[model samples]
Target: MKFSKAEIDAVIAASPRTNLPLSKLVLSEERQVRPQGSTPKLSVAELAASIKDSGVLQNLIVVKGARGLYEVCAGGRRLEALTVLAQADDIPENYPVPVLIVPTDKALIASLAENVFHIPMHPADEYAAFARLIGAGKSVEDVAAAFGVTPLVVKRRMKLAAVSPRLMAQFREGQIGLDCLMVLASCDDHVRQEQVWNGMPSWNRRPAYLGQLLTQGEIESDTDPVARYVTLKAYEKAGGTLRRDLFSDDDKKAYLLDTALLESLATAKLQKKAQQIAAQGWKWVEVRARYVFEEFVKFGELRKTRRAPSGEEAAAIASLQSRLETLRARMDALQDHEGDDDNDDREFLKLDAEGEPLEAQLKALQESLCVWPPELMTQAGCVVFVGSKGTAEVKCGLVRPDDRNGVAEVARKASEVDGDGESLVSLPSAKTRPVHSEKLTRRLTAHRVAAVQAELTVRPDVALVALTAQLAHSIFRDDARGYHRPETVFAITAADCQSDLPTAAEDLQARILDVVTEAVDANAASPLAALKKADAANGAEQTVAATGWLPACLRTRREAGMATEETLQDAPERAASEALAA
Candidate 1:
């Protein structure tokens, strides 16, 4: 049978009123005892304040007990707050606490209903509330205290509230996840936030991607080598600002915004470090943002041999060890009580910080005992750079090719006569070649080729054979350098082989500066300045086709060879020949 609307309403209200009428009764611990369950903890401070300001807003459900007492089956949190006020004498002992009297059997159902149906306010409401509180001139700390949450939490709410209203609405509608809202709220610009949202493809709207999108052009302070070298405070002092991630603990998400400032700071620090190294009597020092390990392999590193520590040094080390042991014992003992007391933890950390520098100093002193000879040090210098580990690294006693003084022949002579160190006397050599100075090499080769051409007429058979061989090679082989101009050739006789090519410049001048230096200083045409650097980039660049002027292959078969002017300068005799004669 169909029922009228009024009849339906009557049927609904006909049942016993579960929401009973509220009445005030004497407050007592013996009566209306609070129930227990695994429930979310209430903020007693906040609740207590509310109760003090306005007496209980909700009626506590109670059950009758023996001796005119009542047991609280529901609204335990309200009872707890009321109890706190009563204990503090803010409320009278027999304070009239408003409650709803119910039967004992139905108390469990009432308690479960009260707890299970209680839904927390949406996060959007929380954000709005926090925003309203802030707009009303309440500080972050004040709002935090009122809400019983951290200042960071209150700030986060305010930030979320500040995001684009559209995005916030989407978040409220459950269209946006917490992570999405959090990352989107990184920037204060609502317009930018909306732009990022619109620009982002639906498939890649992940939190990490959104965070990176928001923080583009910003360098993570912790990961930046410059920031690691210079503290964040120092960067600020040098005029840099950091954007901190509120969601991150301990401000670990700091990002350095002023890149130019960071670079300047890094350069200044590197220059200072370089000056300090140069003060150590190094001939030169270089400063670079990064030093590659590959470059170190190109240079010859002097082997370091340790000298025995003196009595004073040994005693100092022993004393430091004793102190370290004592400190370590104390630290271990303190570690047992760590976090028990703040002061104890501070002391433990302080000792820990102190121990590291001392240990480092000891290690450095021990390392210092090992020495490269002062002579070697004077001949060579070092390079200073910020390594990947965010510390200054000094590579010492690396001798440049130009720094090599004695000739191999002189060293060989000295070793034969007696096992003394290599004599510093210069000897003639043709090993060094001018790969970079192509024009200079061509000129030198031209002179030698002219001489060879004039001499070829007397040695007709050798000339004919050499011309035939050159033709065969030129026709058969695909040499990129083209046919070596026969006019520049310096022919060699099989009976008397020429060990040294005549076209080379002085032994030192023939040595090409590192092509790295050549490319870098190429415009300057001052290879001498870059002679100090042994760069791996130069080695890689040098791996090009071995193209150079060779006079032997460039000589021509000429008829009338003798020149009008025939004068020659006498060459110096070999030192070994002179020594044998004596």
Candidate 2:
């Protein structure tokens, strides 16, 4: 019975196998190679589940025990699992177990051999085997039950199995790793999988890149704003397709295929909301999937004015406010007394329930007082679009650039009227078009240009300064301003100007000239530019600005009155007698 290593293999080969009833088998003390309670409880539970699903698979090595019971020297865990199953009534008390009977002397050696020499199946092989079982007509749930794992685990393994054959071959050869294979498995198209793998450079074949490339052109249901707006269920209901990635932890990590459908749905919903707003008598209403600030910044927005609330509305607002205050006070008192006492807690909950609705009613009543005049609504427009957080957005009282002049005229008339009186001149509706045709516009601009050119010849200083500024702006502009062409005629450039001016001197000098010219002329430039430069000047700029002198081009206005000691003492009088005598 004390055999050398050479004889152990022959003994294993010659062992006799038989079935023994669970009631007649016992775990042997000789099988205590592993420390007592060393096995994890989860592993024991899984083993029990597996045994219950499809009786014990491998045979246990046993020896004759002290009475009629057979002692299991090897596979003590299997014995424990069978006992657990029998106790739980999952299996009958006398369920049969497979065993290999060995001599009493060799029982310890058999136990050691079973524990130490056994190698677990490779992970790749296990996944592949699961795929094969599924392919052999077994359901995912069935396979999971057989293996004592959840269906999700089985699904993940099956997803891995669905990888391109070429990639799988590379995985087996240890060329491609399991992580990269998982990403490839996320894409159901095998051709796409192989193409992605072959297209990637050797150094760039990573899981993250692989995942990104695989799901390119597909919208993510969870993270994408459009998809979140439309909702995954809505997209699917509209006959859209989704590609799932089982390896990802997020349950919503699926890609939506029909992006056009989502966009159409969003546009349609926006249009419906826009129609309701348009009924409020706006001149024009437009809808867009997204709101781009640059596209709409040039439009003028109407000023919002408030009207006094009516008598009934005012009374309701006061009542709601009072009720909200009372509810809050009561809730606060209840909170002060809240403790182990259930009555105080219940009262606090009841009072808290009334607070939100009353506050909401008061807020709604207050906001209802803000309104745009009916005349202004006719001049301005509205825009409806989707916001970045996937909700509908509305922008109202927007006046188009062409309509700003008309709207300003109406506002001026309104200001002149006293006590909400009607305007003396009737305002034109937004539907009115300009009376001048294209031909008339061309003729008018041509005449204006001729007069401007004639005036420019007499004012050489104005022409020179205009030419210099235009040339400087064109030469020293950033890439963001590259699209704007300088609207000037003289393209002056020479080494003489460059020699006279330092590279950095022109920028500061030009800005100073601009500020002085603007202050003298008092002509309003862009409102945005004025705001940006309002507080931008420092002490040096202020010192330069005190000169009060400007180039001829910017000094287009002429002052009729002179500021001298004589004029300060007495008002200047027009000499009318000389013309009357002629």
lDDT tens digits by residue: candidate 1, 62-159? 77666666666667677777777788888876777666665555555555555655799998898988999899999988777655677888999998
Point out where model 2 deviates above 4 Å.
Answer: 1-5, 36-55, 84-90, 165-180, 189-213, 250-253, 316-361, 418-582
| lDDT by residue (tens digit), candidate 2, 1-582 | 454666778778888989989999987776657666677877788798788787788998999888899988888788888888888888887888989989887778888887877898766788889999999999999988877788999999989888877888889889999889888888889999999999999999999998889888998888877777778888888888888778889977789887788888778878889999999999999988778899787777776666799999999988998888888888778778736888888888888887878888888888889787777788888999888888888998888878868888887776566455443222234454433445544544454335445545776655565455545544654445333433222221211111111122222322543554455442422222343333333422443344543322212222243333322211111011111111
- Give the runs in model 1 whose Cα sits over 4 Å from its true position: 1-35, 42-55, 63-66, 85-96, 100-119, 191-209, 270-272, 288-381, 397-582
User: Root-mean-square deviation of each candidate, in angstroms?
Assistant: 19.7, 16.1
Q: Please list the C-alpha lDDT of all candidates, in the order they appear.
A: 0.62, 0.71
* Model 1 vs truth, CA RMSD: 19.7
If scored against the real structure, what TM-score would every candidate get?
A: 0.50, 0.62
**Where does the lowest 10-residue lDDT sum fall in candidate 2?**
571-580
Q: For residue 396, give model 1's deviation from the true position in Å.
A: 3.7
Total clashing residue pairs per candidate?
11, 0
